[model samples]
Target chain A: MRLPKLFKRKASGEVAKDRLKILLISDRVNCSPEMLDLIKQDIARVISRYMMIDTENMEIQISKTGGYGIGSKNPSLYANIPILDLHKSS
Target chain B: MGEVIVITSGKGGVGKTTTTANVGTGLAAAGKKVVLIDTDIGLRNLDVVMGLENRIVYNLVDVVEGGCRVKQALIRDKRYPGLYLLPSAQTRDKSAVNESQMRKLVDQLREQFDYILLDCPAGIEQGFKNAIAGADRAIVVTTPEVSAIRDADRIIGLLEANSFQQIDLCINRMRYDMVKRGDMMTVEDVVDILSVNLLGVIPDDESVVVSTNQGEPLVGNHTLAGRAYRNVCMRLMGQDVPYMDLERSLSFWTRVTGIFHKSQEGRA
Candidate 1:
């Protein structure tokens, strides 16, 4: 019997690319992955106060846009928060 | 006026010195008046690499301190009529020279040479600061490994922060066979991650070791790395030279052996 695909190893090059993508993003923004998590939680808390949101599935990250040229890259925050319902304002 | 360029890498042992020596020699061989300034200070090695260690009478610190004339400290390469070296001080540390002093020295040399290549020391410290202080352009060198790539990214970010408009990347010691086997990152992968203009890619060749041991830059010879360095020099001169085709340059016997190895792996 063959082992499951999940047991197969990833190509080292692909692993390097994946690692660098996240590492570079963090390095560029001067924000650690743990710091990003805190920011994500804060965002979720603020959104939850106004609406019912899927905190478990919310995603937040800092990414770069614009040309890859030196001094041209612009870092911006991206968030994906799922909302199930809206709360009535008091 | 000559253009001042610094060859730097955040991490050590990534071929910054080798690239500086070869590129400087290559440019000189092309009939351009070039001066290579070793700014590593205290950990000086460029002099030995260029085989001019014994000729060093006065060093960078001496010139900066007014202990010697800038012209007096420069050691000319006998092999190239237009090539010279400003050796770093072996007895002093990075703090021996500061930013304005470096700017002044480079400014002085600018009127004389056609190109000024600064071989920057490793790390982002006083030495690094002094190296980039006088540079108009920066060439960041890196290997395909994760540590080197991470450091390169950091260096690029630092260079961008310094308002450098002409930063380029040189990927060194690339192993084509490993890249073909999916064991190493390709040049495209590195370029995509670094996001800097590709200056050139040097293959991992044993001849580079031989050349360095002989105190010679590989630009004059016909080795793979030598050819790559020549292409880099051409690119620096604003010539449109295509990147070397490493795959096609492989020997037929090596290609056949590669196929046989792949078949063995398939059977497993």
Candidate 2:
């Protein structure tokens, strides 16, 4: 059994797959991908308040959502984000 | 019957040979009568990796072609009396043996051995199909790279379609320093992509290469990578062992030295 590089994602009914990953990464902090995306949006909204940033121009993409869902360990997330705080303008 | 397991990777040079060499040795060391078959055919390297190249009088082709008996082609490991190796035919093409012949050979081996380990060739060609045909289970070898994982996913889909449900993943060549620096994929990333149960993770310890080139099995030293192989062997035996922490294997000095070494290479 030779594994090729993983993730040629065919997420047909990706809800379960994506949700499982989301739970692992977030340690089940959020139950659903929709909830996680909303959290990203909410976090983005809160962070923008404390700094000079255009929330409209700010593009948010929470990607690589994955984690262990067996409940043996704490759920976690491996997400990538563009931190506007690092930007010179924001 | 002895369990038949195939170690394969979609991408070449991802340590399929090395994993077979070590894991087979680990099982053998554990007192299981193990046989490691090099199914790579024309691209055979398991013999060299296992340091039994000089002892190969008859190959898999020879057995399937009736030139020699299967027992005559099997090479017993010098280190482990219980371990044996069935080398591939370096001179023959993959066509020399088909899936049915392999199934027959494995079935025969099962009567005498406790485990049958097939070191499969790379790619999803006739060779790959032939390797998995007789496998009771398969260990998909892959590095934590985009291309390797993509091919692994393809292999998984193929295995599932073929009714080979007892499949697992062995992520090899994992570099902790790079993953710490956020430069490479984590175990989570690869497992996420493959969507299979994680069997084991072999770190990119140079000890493996030294052991491979020397035809000595890693189980002898119990190095990080060697221990990983042993742990995987346990898992294959139906134990639910959690994976070792790749981070804990390295101390602060080792990490610092590695970073400095990388910086030196960058400067050079």
Question: In model 1, what are the clashing residue pairs, if there are any?
Answer: none
Candidate 2 residue runs with Cα over 4 Å from true position: A1-90, B252-268
| TM-score of chain A by itself in each prediction | 0.76, 0.37
Task: Give the C-alpha miss distance for residue B223 in model 2, angstroms.
Answer: 1.8
Model 1 Cα lDDT, one tens digit per residue, B194-232: 889999999998988998898988784556787789889
Best by DockQ: 1
Best by lDDT: 1
- What are the candidates' individual DockQ scores? 0.76, 0.03
Give the Cα RMSD of candidate 1: 6.7
- How accurate locally is residue B50 in candidate 1, as Cα lDDT from 0 to 100? 87
Q: Report the poorest 10 consecutive residues by lDDT, candidate 2 chain B.
A: B259-268
Q: What DockQ does candidate 2 have relative to the true complex?
A: 0.03
Fnat of every candidate, listed in order: 0.79, 0.00
Q: How high is the CA lDDT of each candidate model?
A: 0.89, 0.77
